[model samples]
Every structure is written in C-alpha cells, then in structure tokens.
Target: MTTLAEEVLAGSRLALARLLTLIENEDPQGEAALDRLFPHSGRAHWIGVTGSPGAGKSSLVNRLAQAFRRPADGSPPRTVAIVAVDPSSPFTGGALLGDRVRMRDLSGDPGVFIRSMASRGALGGLARTTPAVVQALDSAGFDIILIETVGAGQSEVEIARLAHTVLVVEAPGMGDDIQAIKAGILEIADILVLNKADLPGAENALRTLRAMLELGRPPHEETAESLPVVWRPPLVPTIATQNEGIAELLGHIQAHAAYLRQSGGWQVRDRSRLQTQLEELLQTALLKRWRSSLPEGQYQQILTDLQARRISPYQALHSLLGEPPLPQSIQRGSTALFNA
Candidate 1:
C-alpha cells in the first residue's frame, strides 16, 4: 500500500486526512510515518486557540488564518493547517465537527488545510497522537498551524505546552465561569482574547479581567519590603466573528514568538515538549512489552487474585513482571529498560 506520508508530501488532501485519522487512532503506522517525516519538521509556527465552550475559538482561528495567508516581503505566501478538536458525543463516539462548517471558505483554498478531531476521551484536552500529527503538518511545509481544543475544563491547559503561542478565548456572561478559568487557564495564556466582544457585559468582563491581572501582578521591588509574589500576563480583547482586532492579535502573536526566541524560552519549551513525547513513547512501549510477555491465560488469574484479595495489586503486578518496579532515578538512566 502507498504510505500516507508519501501522499501528504505529494499534496493529496485525502491522504492528509487519512494520515490524521491514523495518528488520531495512534496506529503503529502513524509512528513510522512520523519517524520518516521528523527530519522535515520544525518549519511551522504553531498557535493554540482554546477556551470555554461557545467562546468562538473557531472563528478566531479562521480570522487568524486569513491574517497569516500572506507572508511578509520576500517570503512565500504562508500555508496554514488547522486541527480543531471536539468532544465525542458519549452515545456515538463522534464529534459534532462544527468548526469546519464555519471555515468552509478556506476549505477550497489549497494553502489552507483543516482537520477536525474528536477528543475520544483523551486526557489533557488533546488526542494521544496530536503532537505527531502537528509534526507531520509542520514537516509538510505548513507555515502556520493552529490547534483548536474542545473547550473542556482545566485539562485544556495541555495546549499551552504544545503551541509556541496560546490564545485563551472568553465571551461575555461567562460570569463565575471566568473565575473558573482563572484557576487554571490564566497561567497558560500568552494572550487573553475576549471573543464576542460585541455582546452585552463584554466591557464589564474586560474590566474584571484587567483587575484580576493587576491583582495577580508582583509588587514593585522597592515597595516597603515584605509582600507576597504574584504574576501578571498580557491580555487583549477581540470580536473574532467580525474580524475586529485580529491584526493586532496577530501582531501580538508575532511579538510573543519573538520574545520567546530572544529570551531562550523557545528552545526550553521545545526541549521540554520533546522530552515529554519521548517519555510517553518509551512508557507506552514498555507497557506493551510487559503486557505481551505475560504467559497466555495469566492475566485472568492475576486479576482474579487481586480482586479476591489473595494478594495486593502491587504484589500481583510484581509477580507478573517477575521483578519490582524500577526506582524513579534509575528509570531516568540508560539502564532503565534492561531493569524493566
């Protein structure tokens, strides 16, 4: 069979979609494809858009794409890739797939590629293979890639760890829901966007956010000695539906990207993300090997023994492995796999 990577490199839309599906399913082929493409990656600028449901993140992303369509002087027109994630309906295990509907105009543009992904109950607000898919798109020469989350609760913070710039969207009348966002989402935002800014209570919400940000700031260094530390982040307001303030938003994103690179934060963040990916792959492989090495018919007996209180689950697991779990420090070492 012709591989998805080959098709994607050849600019096949259907092949691109199939590759995304394979990665979403975490198929073994997906890993192989990623390995084949990794050398071609790192060219795209990744932007993550996330917030509460109904925050208009999809619209915001579409506007962002339009803004990024034309690259600066001497540079080629930018190609954008969008990954929109939606929660799967429990009854059917399928996403509503509504983001694409709002972005239909860009669908026909060869420069823009959009893919909708169902969360499929992946923890941390991303599909397990999302990073790999992003890498593929980056390698395929997309200049800008945007990730839109399902807008679930706090776990969506995971998006921050992936993107070079993160825009946290909010709308009017979220009320205490904004407070809920403060608990986790605030820290992750490189830019705070008040979407649906035309709505009632929008100004009030913006004022509240400003106050919250001010309150979160650290006291002046010269201030009369002892005070608690606080952190303040930049915020912006936008009506993404009307495309208002989008240019400014893009400017901020560019500025933030510059800041990350200048301050060395870009390399640090990228290294951390790569380390996390490596650890996850290693852990998955280790678990699979451990599971496959078990004697046939041994699983049921282990489960039964643990359930019946004949032995602790830990003890049963040890018996299955024929060894105790490796210590944390050793697991960080080169010999960890042999120990496992």
Candidate 2:
C-alpha cells in the first residue's frame, strides 16, 4: 500500500488531502492507493443530490452537512463528506470550486470534509474520478458521502449509478412543475425534495410531483410483495435557505438506509456500481491498447477514406477490424500478449 493511503486510513487529514490531489492530477500512485483502499470502503452511505442550477442544491447540501455533523442521541459524532461537482472551464479544465462558499458553517467542523470537483467535460454529471474519490473518503471513515451533481438535466440522472439514495431536488419558479418528469429525473429519485418551499409555486410543484408519482410508480401492494421489497420514494418539502425541514429530510434518508439494509439493496447497489466501473475501465483499457497497437496511419487512412467519401464509416471500421478479433482484458496497463 502507498504511504499516503496508509496515513489516510490512520486518520491523517493532510495525507488524505494530498492523496485526493494526486487523484485529481491523475497520478498513478493515486490509482494504486485507491486499489488498496477499495477493500476498506463500502460502509459510507452515498447520497446523490441533483437539481437545476437555481434549485438551491448547495444550500441544501450545506444544511444536510450541518445536521449530520452535530452529533446527538449518544451516538458518536458522524463524519460527513461532500463532493460538489461543478462545471469546468473548457480551455483550462478547472472548476470554480466555490460550492463550499455557502457552507461556511461547516468549515470549522472537524467532522466534515468538502471537495469541489470539476466535471472536466465528462458526461453524466460527474468527474470520471468521482467514484475513486468517493471510495477514498469512505475508506477514510466518513459516515455519509453526499455527491452533488453538476445540476439537473437529461444526463444528470447518472448519479443513480453511484449513490445509495438519490435526492431529486426541485425549486419553485425554476421551470414548469413537470420539468422533473420531462427530464426523467423523477423516476430515478429515491427521495424527492421540494426546496424553496416558501416560494409561490411550491404547492403546485408538490402537487405535480404527487401526481407524477401516482401515475408512474407501481402499486404499493406490488412493491411490498416483490421479492426484494421495493421502497417508495417520499417527497419532502424544504426551505433550504432557512434550514426548514432538514430534519424531516434526514428522517426520510435514514428510513431509506434502513430499507436498503432490510431488503439487501446495499449489496445490489454496490454490485451494480462495481459492474459499471468494471465496464468503463475495460472499455478504456481496450481503447488505449487499440490505439497503441494500431499500425501508424492505419487509423488515419480509414479516416481519410471516409472523409474523401471513398468508403462508408461502417465499411472503414470493418476494414480496420479483421475477422476473429482478440478477446482479452487489460493487464498491467498493457495488452496481455497471450489469452487473458
């Protein structure tokens, strides 16, 4: 195991920060450390929050962190980790990293760690390295990891692949009450939050969500009788700016956690997430190997042919890939010379 990973597991915040920076920089050491640390993870409950830009996601996340950070009921203090994903600058590939600005109350709290990540033009509302970083935080002993998506949109629902409980937030006046439905975000939520509940259209938004749920969700009897036991999502209204209904929202989250445990949803979710990671890693590895092994100009000639309309794209691809292609996995950052 890397020294930085050792220190991170030993509760060294500085070492943890350094390891995260190494990951952000795409250092090999960071990947090695993550591979080592992966076994120690899987304990933290990941919560993904997604909404439109003006939906008050940051404020809600700040409030959630504060509520979790303040220990109560004889339980030991709960450590929280927040990964706030922001849009990246196209030219520089850097994020503003300003999500923490609204969370000043949590800055002095030793139990909370907030990281702002740039999307880096990755689709699906997350940085490519988000899962690894989340694993890092989980292994370092955070209790709740909040992943705030790059904002609500058609593609933003990808957070469903990463989090145990997904909160689809909406605020009145941001758009039509049915926008969540239109975007397909409502279907993916484990919990729906109507933020800025004090706004004029709050009731209308709630009604719309309720109507959608009634129309889209399966019957409660069917959910209860299902083999794995399905849990219905609850819509909780909140004024995040004033911290209203945070406790109720937390209660819903806790209930979801309990439900996941009872129904074995945790293992199922972990397996799904792992499969996704494996597929993506395999694809990347294969692409890298293909690029490195391709004869120089062979790819470009295909491109040139297509550009000159001498061949169709599919025909060009077929020519590039001969019959009986190799079936193998990546080994040590290189293509295995033999069957693997």
**Local distance difference test, each candidate:** 0.80, 0.86
The per-residue C-alpha lDDT of model 1 at residue 246 equals 88
Tens-digit per-residue lDDT, 1-340, candidate 2? 5487799999988999999888978899999889888899999999999977888999999998887876344566679999999998889977798898888988778889988899889988899989888989999999999999998475687799999999989888766755656768778889989999998988888888888877776755534535435678888999988989998999899889988887889899999998998898899999999888989989998899999999777667767776432333543334455546
Q: Estimate each model's TM-score.
A: 0.83, 0.90
Candidate 2: residue pairs that collide: 51-152
Off by over 4 Å in 1: 1-7, 70-76, 177-182, 218-232, 309-340
lDDT of 2: 0.86
Clashes of each: 0, 1
What's the residue-level lDDT of 63 in candidate 1? 87
Over 4 Å off, model 2: 71-74, 222-228, 323-340
What lDDT would candidate 1 get against the real structure?
Answer: 0.80
Candidate 2 residue 222 Cα shift, in angstroms, is: 7.5
Worst 10 residues of 1 by lDDT: 222-231
Extract clashing residue pairs from model 1.
none
Best by the TM-score measure: 2
